[model samples]
Target: MAEDDDIAERRLAFGRAFIGALPHARALGMTLVDLTEGRAVMEMPYDARLIGDPETGVIHGGAVSALMDTCGGAAVMAHAQTPAGTATLDLRIDYMRSATPGRAIRAEAVCYHMTRSVAFVRATATDGEEGRPVASATGAFTVERGR
Candidate 1:
């Protein structure tokens, strides 16, 4: 294989490794869908215990934001082609509709840009119904320098 191809293979491997390193993420009940050069996909299944309002069975907005933030960070790390800590500079999320309990919510995140010190990303979460997004987010991230 060519040198670039070799590096690409290695980066993908590193993405998986970095993901596995976050055990708390596992306890959060999120599943890794995929990671690419400037993107990451994930899924979170609805659980009543994690729901903000048990009566409504709707997942909390804060929980949705956390998922998006994580996705943005993962996207930055994958696209930077380096292992790094990403801090949320700004995050905006819009809740179009409420999430239903027991449904799996899928998130798709893309890093549109990553400069030397920052990364820009957007992600959306949905439970497959078409009219409205369960949640959507856009954020800027600061990539830490050095260890």
Candidate 2:
């Protein structure tokens, strides 16, 4: 790894140590790909049982939203610069296209602002295709200050 990347690995290691442990996260096959000051990427393998539209074989909108939401909050949490807890304030997901059932979905988040108590984020979910977004989101999350 490059020098900067090595430093980032240490920071992300810290983030992974904090507040990333949730049982449901593992159950849903969520994997944290990277954690930087203002960016994050996560992915999950496609599961047929997660599809709400079984007949259409598309990933569920709700599941898509959850994936987006988690990345958004995780972005803020990773960049929080203080000892604060974080929670989703609002998660708005727009489904641009259906996701392929057999393909894994990846969600990427970018944090534009991290205030004392709120963090602003934007994210996108994709299945490695051109002009096809499984979902996209923009939202803010509350950062609970202090231990």
Candidate 1 to truth, TM = 0.83
Q: Each prediction's TM-score against the native?
A: 0.83, 0.88
Candidate 1, residues 9-59: lDDT per residue as tens digits? Answer: 776677667766777566677766787788888777777767898788888
User: In order, what lDDT does every prediction score?
Assistant: 0.79, 0.81
TM-score of 2: 0.88
Query: How far in Å is the alpha carbon of 76 misplaced in model 2?
Result: 0.2
Where is model 2 poorest over a 10-residue stretch in terms of lDDT? 15-24
Error of 1 at 69 (Å): 1.0
Error of 2 at 147 (Å): 3.9
Best by TM-score: 2
Please give, for residues 1-147, the per-residue lDDT of candidate 2 as tens digits.
599888888877866654268666666788788888778888878998788886988878887787787788778877747426778888888888888778989999998888777889999999989668778899999988875
As for candidate 2, its clashing pairs are none
The Cα error of candidate 1 at residue 97, in Å, is: 0.5
